[model samples]
Target chain A: MEDDYYSIESILAENQKIQCTFKIDVPDMGHLDGGNERDIKALSKVQVPLWMAYILIYSDYADFTIPPPFSARVRSALNAEARSVRLSNLVGQAGLWYGFGRMIMRLLNDDVAKEMSDVLVKTFRDRLPEVIDQAQHFASVHASSADSGVGGDNATMLFREGLDGTERELFALAQDSTRRTKRWYETSERGRRS
Target chain B: MALPTPLRASVTPAELELIASEQLVEIVPLVAMERTAFISGAYGPLRPPTKCKVPIWMATNLKLKKKCRVVPPDWLNVEFLEGRLTQETSEAGFSEMPFRFAEVAKVLLDVAPDDFPNPDKIRSLLKDIREARQAKSREGLSKLDHSELSLPNLCSMEINEIRPFFIRAMGVLTDLVKEAQPQQDAP
Candidate 1:
């Protein structure tokens, strides 16, 4: 609920769509559903941006189904092996699986919100070590490849492809730090000699 | 135009190295010089063949000019690092390491490889220690709690490496906790 107005990431995450069923007749909102009708009817299901859906749900005007990305099937897949699951493919265009899940948690009741948040936290924890390992591995490869002109790991790239937005950012951060340290180690002597 | 982003959640490794350079190191000067005043503090008269303590930055500068030989820190040797590596691998929690070990070791090894015996072996040992410690840190992160994360004895570089991820993860966790709070109060 603490939406930082300046965060582009949060804005992009809010752009994801969720299915909401209107609880009552709504006037002049048919454009939302792309229907010819001038107004949305009661119990009508429509896909709305997450931001708008949150507003509708918060005001008790609509009820939203849990998105397929956070469905029981995904939960089982994550429980089986979180690192292997392709979280990048789970969410909408933003690929903000954790971000989206956190937003959704805000609209749910206590028990369901707790359960969903647990899944989000567990998935993050399970996959974080791999994220760090891959970042470090690629960093070392990059440092050495600059001299040897060798190619990067294909399997690592395949694994990296499955990272969600949050994980991607974390990977980039870890990679940048490792790269900076390696550069410092390799270049400090030369820079001084010159 | 590319506007600058907000401040980073943690200091970069380079910045940490710069800070670590303030730590004093023993150096044997090949050329004699009178006691000199530096912005940080005064360093004593540099008589030839006698070891004197000076900040790492000054030592590295003098060392680069081949005017001094750096005395590698007590723990910078192969045997000590190998022992620490074993402790790191065998322990559940992080082993006690110097707070600025990573930065200091990297700077010293890079600047004064000839000063330390078997520099390559020392480098490999240090790398092994780092890997072992990193694996331990990752295990700690996997057990991360929403309310708190207690990891003692983490070095500066390791802490900085995890800072961005930790801050964001904690933010997400706090948000989730907040979400569940309102419902608990509703009854």
Candidate 2:
């Protein structure tokens, strides 16, 4: 019969020195239901180094350099395939509000976060018509160009023409996830305020 | 089979060659002076009163191409280049250094019109400076020694003093554009 349990005694180990790089101060929680005994506990604290934060922020999109992962690849491919759709131009307008929503959430609660997320989603959805119209116009302009060979009639075609249904669904899912994160942050803030 | 003989062609009539004349525009390159000669009155006892040089580059158009010519007669002696203005004297081993074009633009753009000779001229000068720097950079190599480059002291000054100037300049430019829009809209 095979042995069911692994013994820690048989495991090899090496001793190493560990040094703490950062210190975080947490509020002391006094003892609850104590019988004339003073007990103080420190709240849990996590320390993230400046270098690490810089790396994480710079490395990933939707932070500073690039849009969220969902929009990044889509935007790049679209830009390459069609010259008229400039993904960067949308950032200062719609993306700025989206970022604000995210910031408000991280500073606040889950419920308020969700509400903010809903607001952002609704805003984006409302603007979707304009966005689609702009995209179509750009496509037509490119298609009309002599080098494009594509006719103006086919220029207004959306990503659905090239991408499968699953891919389009995935993009929608990613966008929803981004919105939910923002909503969660807003909710957290509202909870704190209440 | 034998090859057939080639037929000879004959000139039927004399034709007149018409030449079209068009005006050729001659592009004249603009020469702008760069670099400033500063005569500082003795304020400190460390060294005798001396003349310090500030190098400047002015960007101008040469026909179809934009060219940058170095201004301020003795820029190499001043040891000024882009990027390294903020380093302390102790760290940099120099009392003064040159600032980047961006930094200089930020400073000049910040200075109040009341304090400077001519604010608009200064702004233009700063733009030319920036253009020159950019043109030089795009040339694939830097003219100055990279290791010795430094930023000017003016840029390292308080941001508050400089920030408002840029805002004002931007506002003025925006107003100009707004004013021009109506004329453009007119039939």
Candidate 3:
């Protein structure tokens, strides 16, 4: 867990250096309820670092050469699609990473963002099992409540369960988010060819 | 490319069944129709007959066969498989299909009178099916331990293979919607 934490922090540091060169004010974090604001803020702040990492990683996948005319045309079409889809504003270097993370969390489960916060904290503390156990317990409790058909305060319980160990949730979120981002990038590439 | 003539009459369930059957035959292979199935309403049941089955093995087999390399399981229906040969399967996966359909549907639904139920529901249902397929895929992937050397590449290969089928499915769906469209001048 300590190693994981160190790696994550290092990634964050590298990302900050790469991405924050052209800094923009972080957008409004939006409405967070049920003690979720804390977690949201934490996740939001990490976007800066994540974007930095993305630039480095994406470069590994493809060279940053100036796109040819076809690619430029495709990029323009994608930009139009993004605008129509409301993705233009949602995507920037950092904003894109953050949006990707949020979309992953939403797809996995609504409470994922909060859970990731817990995972990051646990990773820092080097208590992987404890985090896992807590998450398991929370999942168990929520399962029971759901089975009983009692909808009582399950949101917090689920959040607690999700947040229980290490940065598993964050890692999952990042993986899915990256996948989606790649899809968008590919779509633009295709638009250029078409 | 020329669009098909607009379907003037409301499709009877019987017509829908026939269309579904024709679609199945055109898209998927000639497997015997199973006992339990759902036929589309566009082609009436008496028409050709579109048979719907859980095709679980077919989905799984596609990954192993290497015919498809990148599509997810939900997109691996018989109809989708047919479309992949001509279309670039990677670009036409189930995910992209619904996204495109939804975009078109939104426009149609918006201009459509208030009485009409949104076509978005169909897109949603398609997405649900895709997710269910993904869940099955996750279960299958779990059986293969992460420690294996070839696991990562194998998983990606499977996904790539499945992508074409999804693209084919999207093409079929687009065809269906276009076929069902009212004439441009009609009310």
* DockQ comparisons of all candidates to the true complex: 0.43, 0.00, 0.02
Q: Please give the C-alpha DockQ score of model 3.
A: 0.02
Residue-level lDDT of model 1, residues A1-194, one tens digit each, is 23689877788778889999999999998999998989999999999999898678877899999999999999999999988888888874438888788888777877788898889888887888788878877787887676564334675565688888878877887777777667765665547542
Q: Number of the top candidate by TM-score?
A: 1
Model 2: CA > 4 A from native = A1-73, A76-194, B1-130, B135-187
lDDT tens per residue, model 2, B94-185: 22333332333332223212334444554554444433432322221111221222333432222122222222222222221212122212
Candidates, ranked, DockQ: 1, 3, 2
What clash pairs does model 1 have?
A: none
In the range B5-34, model 3's lDDT, one tens digit per residue, is 111212222232222222221112233332
What Cα-based lDDT does every candidate model obtain?
0.81, 0.28, 0.29
RMSD (Cα, Å) of candidate 2? 31.2
Off by over 4 Å in 1: A146-159, A188-194, B1-7, B178-180, B183-187
- The DockQ-based CAPRI class assigned to model 1 is acceptable
For candidate 3, the clash count comes to: 30
Q: Residue B142 in model 2: shift from native, Å? A: 17
